[model samples]
Target chain A: MNKTTKSNFITYGMVIAAYVIMQILVGTGSVSSLLKGLLVPLCIYVVLALSLNLTVGIMGELSLGHAGFMCVGAFSSAVFSVVTVDTITNVAVRFTLAIIIGAIVAAIFGIILGIPVLRLRGDYLAIVTLAFGEIVKNFINVVYLGIDKNGFHFSMKDSVSLNMEEGSKVIINGAQGITGTPKNATFTIGIVIILISLFVILNLINSRSGRAIMAIRDNRIAAESVGINITKYKLMAFTISASIAGVAGVLYAHNLSTLTALPKNFGYNMSIMILVFVVLGGIGNMRGSIIAAVLLTLLPELLRGLNDYRMLIYAIVLIVMMLFNWSPKAREFRDKYSLKRLFSKKNAQKEEA
Target chain B: MSFISYLINGISLGSIYALIALGYTMVYGIAKMLNFAHGDIIMIGGFTLFVVMNTLGLPPLVAVLIAIAICTALGVIIEKVAYKPLRQASPLAVLITAIGVSYLLQNVALLIFGANTKLFTSVVTVPAISLAEGQINISGETTVTIIASIIIMIGLMLFIKKSKAGQAMLAVSEDKGAAELMGINVNATITLTFAIGSALAAIAGALLCSAYPTLTPYTGAMPGIKAFVAAVFGGIGSIPGAFIGGILLGIIENLSKAYISSQMADAIVFAVLIVVLLVKPTGILGKKINEKV
Candidate 1:
């Protein structure tokens, strides 16, 4: 097999093996509920990191509004499930529909925001995306939505302004967020979504459009001179990345009984955390992003004993990880002992044997 | 009269934003990476001032000076430890490191100070200015912040235009390799930029807390972000641009809060940023650099 194919297989193998081992641990009751509960969030962060890598690593854009897209997806999907809870009696089917709704809505937001922002140059996209995220969060805070026998009611003032009938129900409670969100998200389903996301992201990275996208990232002017459509590829990568993040959002929303767009959950902190994962994992390396996400997400929980020091250690880890991934000496050492070297060495030994 | 009051308040807030944006613009100009930890420096400055003034019973001038010195030292140390090694790395890597430093400072502050909001005593003891038969009242902070920011802006412009070190900064930013060849110490220039920026943060923090009168661990985060938006609005590297952007942003935000919904004012400010960028991508005062093939 060719080098790229073999490496891709190894990436898949790593994920599947990890999943199997986790299942065995669960089967034997060796894993605590706290650790087990972190499983789905682990998948969510993994997906977020990978999708962000597509923008920051492959497309060569620093997007700081990823949490905004996630918020959009989470809210939209939760609303969908809430509206269709009685009509769509089947849990799996309803969840499938919700995921689709989330992905589409986030993709639309991505496209709308990306068009004008992407046309600009020199850090405009980054700052603009950050502003967009804040705007989304701010807008979500004042929004109040309710449903009555007649139809839907929306208001920006308060619940009293919704003017719902006697039998009406409020789907969204403004700053209180949506309650009664059915928690159907499970470890197995999250893993399936992660695998699907990996397949899509990895395949796209190795495809023709991916090459065009990377070319733009390498040298936008040169890529444009070579007849490549710069805006088209950028928009495509951004939209796909947003949709994948949206799927993660769907899982996130369903994992909780109530989904609120709190600053802690859907703020710049979350976006920066995902960026840290992407950077620490070695940008553009899909498998590395996953590994970094998994490790960093679990690090704080494992350090819960040192409650106050948890964030401090996490901060130190961020700095150390960046150095390990990007420092010159570290890069030299990593290059010298990269997986390709091991793979080639084994092939040479087999030939000799 | 109320409209006049809000305008005066807006200008006061804008001056503080201008001070913070100067830090962001200077750092971005020389180093070409957004120092995300800059906001935290503002927080540190406020806390230092708080501790010195309240806890130790130090006077205002001494507290301000101490805050500036401490912040300048901290900025230089952060650059040396967290950023210097990655000077040759990609911008993204440098940015992530800046973020790490920001979190480290925040977490450390939280550990030491706890989460309660500190009621900051205003260092500005100047009496309020009452206009239009007391229909409009402007505080001493308004007078001081506006005047101080203007003086600092003029001083910074002169320094950049005339000083040897400032010229060295311009040379390094224009072309680092050429600057090095011409015997300029690029590293020292960057360190100086960080020093100036952090010093500005301390001053801004003093003025900021005096105006707002409250301090928290995360106090700097939002205003830091807003000033960043201001910097970008003015053109990231242009000093005058940062000033104009800060003023305009403060005015718009204040007016929107008064006339429009208070909760949506943040959204309106951001929306204005988007519209402005769409019209002028390089920003109001940003010079367009041609790409060399």
Candidate 2:
């Protein structure tokens, strides 16, 4: 095997090892309760930030509706888990089926949303995505088609009806929110899912498809001239990013065991927060995105004592960072030192040895 | 009668949107960059009026004047601090900075004035004016909004066509380099453009607050986005086009909400934008520019 391949394998092994160790610590109560609380959100946010980085940073598309996609996944999974586990006798089969259903449903919605809005670029794209997010939230809020019988109106209430009963109707309460979802998201499961998402995203970024997406992002006209199919690649990035966001949403819903109204989950503020993470992490850099996601997710929790002042401080920090152009070191390294030169130097050193 | 009143109400709301759209258009014309924070400036103006009128106990009219003046200054400051430095940067950089400025201003407002909504009472105490068949009645707030918007739009048109400074702004918008070579102070002209745009926005904010009466830190976001859409719909760089576009968008959105479902109103508006773009990418009034690569 080539040295690069061997090194890549080692790196993957180390990452897997680290994830396993971290999972064990959380699972076995080896870490402090506070650290565990911090780690859970951090892991989830890392997936969110990295996935968003692929779209906004690497693909140079500003998507402000990522949270909407997440909401899609979360609700879809929650609904599936609620319906399927009751019908299926086997526990493992039910759980596996729910996850597959959730991810697939989210991916379908992602493609549906991506096709139209991916054609818009830059601020226009941002605005359209933002509108889409709001629209999704609103749509979820008002979509109440099921019956309103005495003592039990929607699927949420206790009508004592079995899953898939002839008389039973699916009803999503508008603005009142979806509640009483089953919490099946353990630390191990969340970590595994995050790892898988990271692997897929990293692999995609290294592949030819990823390069083409980046090319389109850099110069759409040129990419189009070279027959790179800008619209298709843009949609691909959108779908992939949306699907990852959906997974994060599923984890969030299962972890919380309750969700506010659709609007609550998929609001403009959530979208902005996601964008902020992408920006704070040094846009387009995977490691930077991961670090930023973790830090930002924890910062408010760390400053909980400050109460109302926490968001104020958070805003100030962001502004100061932006004003100073305080980017992560990895970004500077990538910009300053070309990959070709670094690889050539390493190759020369190997020859000398 | 109430339905007619709502219709009149919609038109007045549309007028304020048109006023705000002018600011978006003017800045985009010169910079070719959307000033995403422009709506925040309107928020600042409204908050400033609140501070001056309610906090300091000034007369409402005086407070509004003070807010307008402050917003004009803030506009100049925003241009210098956030936009001018990144003048040569990629459009994306400037756009991001604008977003940052928007967030910065919003958070600052949130810190100063908590998240709770504030009330801004109407300055005029006159009763609603009734029109034909007693079906259409204009509230004092609506009348003020319409009159103020018309006066402002006409004054702006006259200034751009007649005044020396206004002509300098026009010249700068047309070609900054040539305008600079022709002895126009480009920086001052740009600052003036911002000032005028922001001053107009402040007036719109005051008028809107009077009509609506509730204010929040993030309230400007939707209006900002809508005004931007209006600007683009009218043709981003055209002043008159912005006014027409803004009014049209406002009317369409209001009418859609009134006739159709309110939830589908935004979808319809965006659909219109998509259709318009598909037909005329340069927009209704926007001139096409040839690029040299």
lDDT leader: 1
Docking class of 2: acceptable
lDDT of 1 by residue, B99-198 (tens): 7898999999998999899999999989999888989998989999999999999999999999999999999889899999999999999999999999
Please list all clashing residue pairs in model 2, or write none if there are none: none
Q: Model 1's A-chain: what TM-score?
A: 0.91
- With candidate 1 superimposed using the best TM-score fit, by how many Å does residue A33's alpha carbon deviate from the native? 1.8
> What TM-score fits each model?
0.94, 0.86
What DockQ do you compute for every candidate structure? Answer: 0.65, 0.32
**Candidate 2 overall lDDT versus native:** 0.75
| Highest TM-score against the true fold, candidate | 1
Backbone clashes for every candidate come to 0, 0
Clashing residue pairs, backbone N/CA/C < 3 A, model 1 = none
Q: What TM-scores does chain A show, candidate by candidate in order?
A: 0.91, 0.78
lDDT at residue A258 of model 1 (Cα atoms):
89
| lDDT tens digits, residue span A170-227, model 2 | 5455555566666677666766776787678777877899899989878878888899
- Tell me the spans in candidate 2 whose CA falls farther than 4 Å from its real position: A1-21, A24-39, A89-92, A145-170, A262-264, A317-353, B1-3, B262-280, B289-292
